[model samples]
Target chain A: MRDASETEKAVRLYAGTVYGIALSHTGSKADADDVFQETFLAFHSSAKVFHDDEHIKAWLIRTAVNMSRRAVCGKHRRAEELDENMPGGRFEFAADEQNDIADAIRALPEKYRAVIWLHYFEDMPVKDIAKALGARESTIRSQLMRGRERLKELLGKDWFEDE
Target chain B: MNKIFEDMKTQAMPDESTVNALIESLPEKPRKRGIRFSHIAAAAAAALSMLTITAGAVSDWTFSFLGDFSSAFGEKTEAYNIVESASYSNSASDMTFELVGVSADVNIFRVMLDIYPPEGTEFTEENKPCMNDNITFDFYLLNAHKGYGASGRFDVLSDTPQKMRVMWTYSCSAGIEDREIEFVAKKMTRTKDENAVNTDGNSIITDNEGSVIKTEEIWYTRIKTGSAPQKVKYEPGGQAIDLDRLPDSDERCRIFVTSAEIGSMSVKLNGLIRGDLVWRDSTFTAVKTDGTPVGLIFSGGSTIGGEPSSGLKDGDIILLFDDIVDPADIASVTINGTELVFK
Candidate 1:
């Protein structure tokens, strides 16, 4: 276990990254919330040593990604109605009116969505994304290519030029 | 180029309340590397490694690293060795599960496995190998069966594009013997969708296009070991009391323990207690026979009847002790006013 201060500091520093990864994977705010808590709590409980802040960040990203998938799958299998008021209450895919690019990302398949989210939103290189997700760099590269093509199909080629 | 993606990144940022909830939910104790619940025990076991190094001490129990599960249980190693002969293959998914190595002692056991997924399987977040939640098994010791309550954990020590290594370590206060371990996985939900699944170890698998990938077989394994536990015998005298038998008391409270053990990682002190008490995560001052403070270890007990609300009756109790570096030299433990003297 890490010191309380270490955990608290990480929570402050990377809550955004962890929460974003969870939110992208699960879509439901409630599930994101659950994964967010679980990721940090998992960090608090894990005895895995961290060499530096980058290592810690990488650990958090990996944990968040895996936990988010589990959370979504469990929610689907239970089929239990969540309290609509809760963040994880619904398996929602509705994008903000102002963010059609976000909607396009959401519209992609889970495999591509994850690869795309980490690459574009996080500004991570393909090599780093491959490491974070434990995939071959070639696999990540191809997934990014496919994800971008899917995005272009969804939003058309103009959005690529706009960016 | 990713301006919109960057702008909306903060939209998912957890609020102050969510952050506070996480902070509030921080576990009170540090966890061991193997098991989730045995935090204090794991933390203490970790410290044992440091103490072993600083003093330049050496023992059969002295482990340079706890990452190797096989070295932790069954028998201590002059060196770590993994037997690859025990491989079990599930042909349907082209996944082979091999029991690479195992070790067990009187109070604990460890098993290591090498999981080889199909050649084309990608290590993506969407494509994951099975975890503890996906597998269940029964452990038999001298024909006695245990389906649950084996304090253990399955951890993925390393995962790569080619292979994944998982190690499980468990402890019992009473003791564990070399026996056959039977694992039957009912379903392999490697993927959430209908794209992949297996029933037993030998089910047929199909891709999204319904192409037959591999014929799955029963993902089961039977492991037999020859080593016996190095059990320490204890004297049979401790303070005993009964309240129900007393004419002045009507409280239906009792506790009984058939065995007690103290390992380098955790302590299990099973004893009989007489009081209107429930044993769950309660605090008790613990010390070695030498007065070395056994810091942050927790003890739990159960009653004869079912249900969480029932008072503890004359039933088995197990204590998980967190920090005892050189338990080999210790002869007993003192919890509260009661002392258990081991021979």
Candidate 2:
């Protein structure tokens, strides 16, 4: 029921968030592109109306998570390791550091990586992140703590201390 | 890490051309018109067709029934055997309710309806009208048939800011034999200023918790159940269970394991407990040949003529399992300690 103009506005506003979640979850641009297209098509066709910008964002995030999970579950796609060449890999940080951090995140399990991306990268609070991912806040906290520890080990002591 | 995300925000978004292309592919929005049932009656029919097309394009299958209804009835136009179709307009609530179609058979009676609200109406969690608590449909047989009355619950096939498409299914004690059915809606209330909450933004008022604060004027509508133009028999594939073999249990009065498709199973149950108690997620268990327990992924059902958990009489239930990788792998299903084995 969302008009084209409203949908365009939504795409302009949240395309990065949706694509970022998909890319972070799948670790591949091809899969990310598929998930991105599906997510927006769903938004345009969705019957549920949004209350505010926050609800729209949350719904898109939730849809992205669900689509990413389905994409992973359906097939055995080749998972490319996150590196300097990956989409969104070239950050403000040094090349090696960014690659290392990205690799560390990508190496984590899907559950942990999802929580970490939503929590640290997206700046989402634990409660909202839990709602978005349809998990308990406690579960999100647990995953965040464990994911961070795993990142610390992967990034080494010096890199960890710098944070 | 934050810097990485900021960079991701800049680089990961889809380009403008991709967004434009996607927008171009979507169906154009229907033009806004006066709130009249007759005006959008044809649009509602088109919406039903669009529902099927949309379901196929989108992967989310939550509303698959809408698509199924369109395909199953559209082709055999005469198979649905629609009994009646009625439209009502409530100027006070600025809403229109139409009984689009109704079809009945020996076992099941189904009703399809479309509710059109004024433009700009919102349907968010806080703003969405609580259909379960506020709306009630009282169905009665006009010609004095076998059953006392029809009992069933409504499931929303699609909901938008403009219109909500819903399907109601009931277990009929007898078939429609030249008998007419009447649906009377009672005490229908909608939330007017749902966003009006406490200053802290909590929806709960200071004194009235879980109670309607600012209620819109009450409206009621009576419409005859529409007869589907044709009578279509929908037969799902899978293994059927022998009714006599189902074990005895206090929770379930009687259960018919009708079919087991690849990843899902359907059942009709009359539970022993009171209230509209449909099957719970924890009530059933499935296992594969390797003896690994399969988790119940989803369970959906509609109650006939009672409140949820008010005990079940008879209703259609669909159970989807996590370990149903292949239909051939299913070993057995245990419901309330009564196991039904499959060879």
- In the range A1-163, model 2's lDDT, one tens digit per residue, is 6787888888888888887777666666666677788887778766676788888888888677656654543333235534646564433333556656666776776567667777776778889987565454886888788888888888774232214
lDDT of 2 by residue, B85-139 (tens): 4444333222233343343332233333333233344344422322232122222
Off by over 4 Å in 2: A77-100, A155-163, B29-343
TM-score of chain A of each: 0.83, 0.80
TM-score of 2: 0.41
- Tell me the interface RMSD of model 2, in angstroms: 13.3
For candidate 2, what is the recovered fraction of reference interface contacts? Answer: 0.35
| Interface RMSD (Å), every candidate | 10.7, 13.3
lDDT of 1 at A84: 56
